[model samples]
Target: MLTIAPAQAPSAADLWAVLTALRLLDDAAEDAAAARIEAARLTDETRWQAAGPRRLRQALTEYTVHLARLADELWFQRDQIARNALG
Candidate 1:
């Protein structure tokens, strides 16, 4: 038989760090979304003719969507953490 140790509670500093990181992630997600829009506009305007502007735009759009989903997940986690901490 084996015994497992109980999980330790997170410290205030740890929670603060996680919250800060979440904020940064949210900011990055917003930036990525803006970049995706700009990429699409540039590709459509024919000014970003860099051999594969369409491909670049597609990749940026995908990246932006992924970042947005990740931000949503992190926000949910942050909310859960807050609820737990408060209760």
Candidate 2:
């Protein structure tokens, strides 16, 4: 007769790898935010007279919020994995 075992949870190293990737993604999001700010500053007042600047800022804000949420979730997961390892 053949038998099967239950699948194991992710190892600490695996969790670390996910955390590292999340950090990299956060770094990229930060870079994007900086670039967006610089681009807005470089735009002329005439362009701001239109709706472009307002729309761009709104989009940037939304994207930043999304990134923040993702980062928060990743941090939460990383902490949970660490606690599981310890206890």
Candidate 3:
């Protein structure tokens, strides 16, 4: 998902929303990882049903990283805007 920060100053509300979404995504990734581990424990050597959950966990991990980058960029941009305002 592509998140475009607003052209205007970043509001506290916007940051809060992003943080909440990130938390939920983190929780889901953790659950998926747990499921993968359980599947590994329960399944036989020949069984490979955990692949889907494993892939999901990886994807979620990547998504979290992407969101974190976005958040960082948002803060940097907000800081730049503030500096420009101060000058």
Q: Go through the candidates in order and give the clash count of each.
A: 0, 0, 0
lDDT per residue (tens digit) for residues 1-87 in model 2: 988998687788986786676566566656655654554454333244458777776666666566566656655665665566544
Q: Name the lDDT value of residue 50 in candidate 3.
A: 89
**CA lDDT of each candidate?**
0.65, 0.61, 0.56
What would the TM-scores of all predictions be? 0.49, 0.46, 0.44
What would you estimate as the lDDT of candidate 2? 0.61
**How do the residues 1-87 of candidate 3 rate in per-residue lDDT, one tens digit apiece?**
999986786578866765565556556555655555554444323333588966665665565555556555555655554455433
Off by over 4 Å in 1: 47-87
Question: Highest TM-score, which number?
Answer: 1
TM-score of 3: 0.44
Per-residue lDDT for 1-87 in model 1, tens only? 999998788899987876776677567656755665665565456545576876776676666566556656656765675566544
Off by over 4 Å in 3: 1-49
Give Cα distance to truth, residue 26, candidate 3, Å.
20
Lowest lDDT 10-residue stretch of candidate 1: 39-48
